[model samples]
Target: MSKRGKVWLGVAGLVINDEGEWLVVKKSYSGLKGKWSLPAGFVDEGETIDEAVIREIKEETGIDCQVKGLIGFRTGIIRDEISDNMAIFLATPRINQPFVKSERELLACEWRTPKSLVTDHLTSAMLKEMASSTPHETQFCVNETVDPGDIFGYTSYKLFF
Candidate 1:
């Protein structure tokens, strides 16, 4: 890896409904506009990955959800310089409500069947795989909610298992 490379942490959520449909969105901010994908964004400083995933899902889809566990993650080098790593989380909605897409951040928001998402050409490979598989099948990791004061001097620390 080059010394000039930087790593960016991101989060995505697989928000599943009782009907087994997954929530997804189309980005409106960049060239990726019109492409369907899981609601995802860069993790903000001072925020945990699970918190980031929940926030992203709410901001993009307008549906509140709680993180159940982490299903998986993906890491790759962008242009051989920037390192991109994303954590995929399994979550469920907290209330029965409709999803309102953010006009500035999303082109569309809708529920998609696992098969539909998996077959869609516009969906990314990781998103497709996550949609097609369940958390149990993927061997999910859960936040152990360890105390930061006990483990480290940092104000905030999260350990997953």
Candidate 2:
């Protein structure tokens, strides 16, 4: 069986706090409602991934950030039943700005210690990734019986430091 492919481009931010915690948002909309994950969203056409990341951060957290470096990439099946390619980037919050959660995209936004996330409710991959100090590469097809090609199209992005 061949999987029907659909391409998706997304950006995620690894925002760090003074306490060494990471900023994450609790999605309240479709797809992954109530699930804890990094602040992220789909990239608009003609929009650079870096722009998307910064925009998403402000939309979801209402804070300005400076991109630091590429954290890594995460490719997997989303609850929408589509394959998603996400580029994670490390970011530092700008000084003297407060973040207000956007009720449209997030129900709550908070800073969580890396260690706290490991024990609390979080995406399995997110928890594991946070536990590691070094960048890692990982790929897995959910519902293994489905063919990768038929499952989704590959979306690509360029990383900017």
Q: Report the lDDT tens digits of candidate 2 across residue range 40-89.
A: 98887788999999999989999899999776666665444666677888
Q: What does the lDDT read for residue 18 in candidate 1?
A: 95
Candidate 1 lDDT over 13-112, as tens digits, reads 8889999898888888654567777899888879899999999999988999989988666665454456667788889999999888899899889988
How many backbone clashes can be found in candidate 2?
5
Question: What TM-score would each prediction reach against the true structure?
Answer: 0.77, 0.73
Give the clashing residue pairs of candidate 1, or none. Answer: none
Residue 112 lDDT in candidate 1: 88
lDDT score for candidate 2 against the true structure? 0.69
- Candidate 2 lDDT for residue 22: 82
Tell me how far candidate 1 lies from the true structure as C-alpha RMSD in angstroms.
Answer: 10.3
lDDT scores in order: 0.74, 0.69
